[model samples]
Target: MAKGKKKKSQPKGKTITLKMAQNSMELTVDGKRRLNLSFQEIAAVPKCLQKLCEVDELDMSRNLIRKIPDFIDQFVGIRVLDLHSNYLEELPVTIGRLQNLLVLNLCNNRLTSLPNELGLLTKLQTLHLGLNQLDTLPASIGLLKELRHIGLSDNRFTRVPGCISRLNNLQKVNLDRNPMLTEDTASQESVMISESLYVVTESFLCEHCRKKLKNKKLEISNINKVQFIAAIVANMFLGVKW
Candidate 1:
């Protein structure tokens, strides 16, 4: 080895090709505001996204991202955030600001614990945390009264988190592949949700309203009246445009 020679520094992040962004980014689509940055191999969330204040969906899955930026809270209208198949070890505290968020997919990450602010996603219905290293969940998770589906399989749990029992609206749960869980316990933990859960895709959901109808019993008219009034007050006080 030469005494004076220094090794070359590694590149910090990967770049998305212009063509890839052009084809996948929803900036060209007039009806919906989405940014599909998935499978880009990037190591960080691009700073350009901070300009999109009305983004409805952002997919950063299948990347090399290690940490979430605090600026993510600025997307006040965001309803779907996909960060699956990333290298995330922890989430940013600003994520709680996504008041309109309904779907949050963090599958296949390296997370060992979730932030307490996660409970602030009161409107969230579908939460995917499968294929992670979590053994326990924050007690604040019980605050998610609207949550219906949760994926916690392939983690380090010895027993089901007690918070799951508090979710009266939860209809679907997955606790598979945990080493310490018995077959009997797995049967007891998993819920048999109706097909209506899968039938209500995020894309099919109401865009501006963003209210979730759990089953056939709820009327869209009723939800619109109540949610509209509440949304008006929230917008006026919180400065949120949703």
Candidate 2:
């Protein structure tokens, strides 16, 4: 019998390094300084983030990061921070240091609550907290007077947060799929996906997904191929370009 090829180990629980973060960063056409480290199998934020002092945007989504370090306060100059689709159970109070932040994304995590310090982002215009385990938000969220859009879909809320109605600048708010909000869910999902929610600079989730959607090889030890296939199919059916 012919010998079988050896199976390769899949990357998992990896922590991103300084070089990796540096290599993933680039300036955009609009002159926004950005660093994108999504879907890199990272399990933690790199300490090197402190060195990127001037960065305006930082994307660390779709990884396995379990805790955002206190050093995150170093990103005071940042305007956007994306931390969706990870395993975060809670956010560090230090996250409030990003006073200049305009957008913050925290979807699809395990978070049940948020730090009251989040209200410090006074200049924030958009905040997404959908697809989490949260049943409530810190009352401080009401301090976001400049907030224009907020996403609270697919959560455990029994009723809309009262603070939402107080946001004088709010132009859009999504609460579909909540235990108490589903009566209007199906009809609102399409509108939410089309005009609001899931903010992204590019059409695709990442360059790797863009080029290897159908044939991306992976070791199955730590992955659920069925779920992966379902996600791809659902995105396609929904006409999402990614």
Candidate 3:
């Protein structure tokens, strides 16, 4: 009679320890990156996390964490940090120490204000802070020259800070669901319209605004075609002259 195959033994060592440390925490591997901790009901950061210096991504979303520990700075190599859907009311100033961070998600929290030190993340590309209670942003935000996308929807802002326009690399901004924005300022065809920038608001577009926005887009498209034709003609002329 054929014997039943032996059951595969469970993997051991630190990998197993991390995988089985807490029932609330789920650890998974993605390539060479380690899963520090995530999706747990933890109210505080674990001390063991400080030893994970090589970890590049840490996802602690959907937890009950109320405060960020200063030891977070110890994760020097972290590039992406996801702390969404937590109970965080404020951030530790040490957050700025994550100089290598590229993406930060703090959406759906209880944050009412931001620390100026956040501007220290010069390499940050995407920042999400929607569904918070923030009323103002620090001027230092302008220093993030590499930022491409920012989410500020569902916040308490009467007007967007002028500093946002200074970010030359910004491609999209979400301002939907903000109650303080005036009808004129939040209009779909307002001066905020641009060929490269997209702004989202909660208000409905009027007939006149819709027409204006459509015309503006058509005008921009025509200009682009004209420039492309001009370049082709110039190239042909150069070939003939040569």
Give a tens-digit lDDT track for model 3, residues 5-108.
99996322122234344333334555546454556567776666665556777887887788899999988888889999988999999999999999999999
Clashing pairs in 3: none
lDDT of 1 by residue, 1-242 (tens): 66987789744778765555556668534576788888778897777667655778888899889999999999999889999998999999899999999999999999999999999999999999989999899998999999999998888876678997788788777776765544677465643322221222344457553544444336866788899898899888988776
lDDT of each: 0.81, 0.82, 0.77
Per-residue lDDT over 97-209 for candidate 2, one digit per residue giving the tens place of the 0 to 100 score: 89999999999999999999999899999999989998898899999999988998888876668877667778777877766633567654422222233322223347776
> Judged by lDDT relative to the true structure, which candidate is superior, 1 or 2?
2
RMSD of each: 16.7, 19.5, 17.6
TM-score for all predictions?
0.69, 0.69, 0.67
Score candidate 2 by lDDT: 0.82
Count of backbone collisions within predicted model 2? 0
